[model samples]
Target: MRHACFLTVGPARFRIGSDWRAPIDQLRALYSDYPMDEVVPDFTVRLQATSALRRFVRPQVAIAGDFTLPDAVPLPLHHGLLAAEMAMNLQMALGWRRHLLLHASAVSRQGRAVVMTGVSGAGKSTLSALLAERGWRFLGDEFVLLDPETGNIAPFPRPISLKNAAVAAMEHEIDDDSRFGPVLRDTPKGTIRHLRPRTEWIEQMARETRPGLLLFPRFGFPRAVRRMDEAESFVRLTQASTNYVALGERGFDALTGFVRSVPACAIDYATGDEGAELVERLWSETGAGAGDRAAAA
Candidate 1:
């Protein structure tokens, strides 16, 4: 049997048969126009589509050993495909030994990249949109992959996911022409919007950037900017990182190395203007202003 489904996150390919009783062939019979690829032996998954219940007479069929979620809803939907795509992207990002994946937003200016690491409510997306509007190149809004070997950051360049007040904050920062696409209303995270990527940087979306500074930004009162010591910064960063649980010992080593090698700080502010100024000051102090390369070791 043949079946075809495409995902947006990574490589757009799929094959629906081989390990399971020729399901792909059955699919091909129904939809001759759909494309098909021979399923690889290693790619195993169980079949649990609602439609399968009528054909197999079993509640679920184990496809290639991976258990598919039981189908109470519908069959042949894109949920599995979507999950696979996300997994693939996650795998690809983690595959690089040179990179330690952090949950953050990254932006580049004058060839230097600054990564902002924080939790969901930590103003990362807001700061990222603010920086992009001010002519800084947007690397990514959620994931910052820092190369351990070269100390450079690579761009994942996914859509900038913003929530609630951030939407208004971004609207105020950018003109209508520069606004990213449209605002998505009433998302799970509360009225979300995805800022479209800058087209000029699309080709270089996967390019690596040298780590100039690591920032932990927060939105709060009594705003203050302070440079943190390496140890303190490392502690805070470890807490803020996303994939640290998966990285384990290797993650620890990479995080420690990064803190020691680069300048890290915490910026507390209530507005984008202060955040932008703090970032600008960091770049200037590091000697990475326009037309200037960061000072060499």
Candidate 2:
């Protein structure tokens, strides 16, 4: 806990303390666009050595914070940056109660947001990152914050964690080298790197957008789109949400209202390009309908 840094992403502020300075330095450089001023943090994460001897020997970083998994394995010192990121995610997943936390990625355009969620490797993260590079404003690449009372989407705008093929794909899409973090190979989810979102999106993190569309995207498949019903979308989202049951009735009301309000679809695409195209087409159709429905209501 000798080295520490404060980070504010959207509605959450985090204080990450590390046993070594390397992780803190990495965080500072990557999150340079974010608000790092000293403030009361919503959550705290600690990166400590696995053992007293490990601090001097082959140092290993263990995730310790307000909420932690007892069976979590420690990462080597070289992967301390990833460990810090993971620790922050753990804290948000278990501790955050201000909003309904959906394990999804989101993007906004014309003041309306699209929420995408699916299993890991489902291409939601990649799709959101790709759209961010395009005309869409990146809201978040991890958790989509849904205000329980208003049912609006709060932007998280954390760095997008690109894994395996995604890392290279984004590198090809974005020419700027300064926006990417160091590559950490052979991690839990394979080779991983962080892509810093556009500075404008980071600066606009506090702005919230109305939900326009809900997508469940699956990658590496032939292109297809299926309309999803409210009941099914509700059940799926309950599974996708990290703190749904923890929030109890408030979570249920928020989620039900969300599914009922937005148009839901399950999209499958073989490549990132196709995925982006699918989203664009659907938004044109569904987004217009959302506008009409809002007017009618």
Candidate 3:
């Protein structure tokens, strides 16, 4: 690979090498503020031609990196930023064991973190970004890193990936005009855009916050909030965590401690405003400064 870009996000460092220069340039521009002081990355991502003939024929980009799935497929070069982001996520999901990784979005305020995870189209990213815009400091939009030892969330704070309707949601909800990335079209998730988290989030990336609440968010539903029992929360978290099985006893202990330490809730909402108001009400009911675990499912 002739062109390369290196960046550090939270505790993970990445080196992205590209056969074509354009993708690397784009990554460099977006992650311009991330530190590059470390010479070696925790993981390396390679974006190269799919095949010998495919290289010159159609010019497709294949995401092959330090770690990859056997069924991994190549993507068009135009979506290289997405590929790079996916590659980094793959590394964290498959290789990271230093922390309990949850496919969640998170935000922090006053030493407490709100972690949200759910199935696709759950609007977790949009919700976390919205919370950041309001008052909470965005921890991350991709993977929420929970330290197995301390149970505190270490910020990943990467760009928020908004898909389809989410693009318009942020455009109308947030006032800042400069925090957005280019609108990419005709991709896996339809029209996609990247929104940079506020600068405060990045500056406080090293800061860790204790879990305040665990939320399973569902969008396009009537507004409701239900308590999730520890038993069910544990099962859901196992599915949410990519390296839970790999961590064995350590993973079990970390997860058990987490569920027992924090309260879990399943919330359904039709719009962002409703979701925000409901969460505020829930927080207030939890007794303000304390993190109160829901007593029953």
Best prediction by TM-score: 2
- lDDT string, candidate 1, 156-274, tens digits: 66556667888777766666644353444543355665565655555566566777778888876457778889989787777766566567777787788888767777888877788
Instruction: Kindly list the per-residue Cα lDDT of model 3 for residues 1-297, writing each as its tens digit.
Output: 788878888888899898888788877777766776657889999988888776667678888888998887787878888888888889889999889899999887667888899977898888898888888889998899889888888999998999999899999987777777777899888988888887777877888888888899998899989999999999999999999998888889889999998888999999988887777666656543453343331
Which pairs of residues have clashing backbones in candidate 2? none
lDDT of 2 at 28: 98
Cα RMSD, model 1: 8.1
Give TM per candidate: 0.67, 0.97, 0.94
lDDT winner, 1 or 3: 3
Model 2 gets an lDDT of 0.94
Model 1 accuracy (lDDT, Cα): 0.60
Q: Highest lDDT: give the candidate number.
A: 2
**lDDT ranking, high to low:** 2, 3, 1
Q: After superposition, how far is residue 139 of candidate 1 from its true place, in Å?
A: 1.0
Candidate 3 vs. true structure, TM-score: 0.94
Q: Write the per-residue lDDT of candidate 2 for residues 1-297, one digit (tens) a residue.
A: 699999999999999998999999999999999999889899999999999999879999999999999999999999999999999999999999999999999998878998999999999999999999998999998999999999999999999999999999999999999999999999988999999999999989999999999999999999999999999999999999999999999999999999999999999999999999999889878753465456668
Question: Model 1 TM-score?
Answer: 0.67
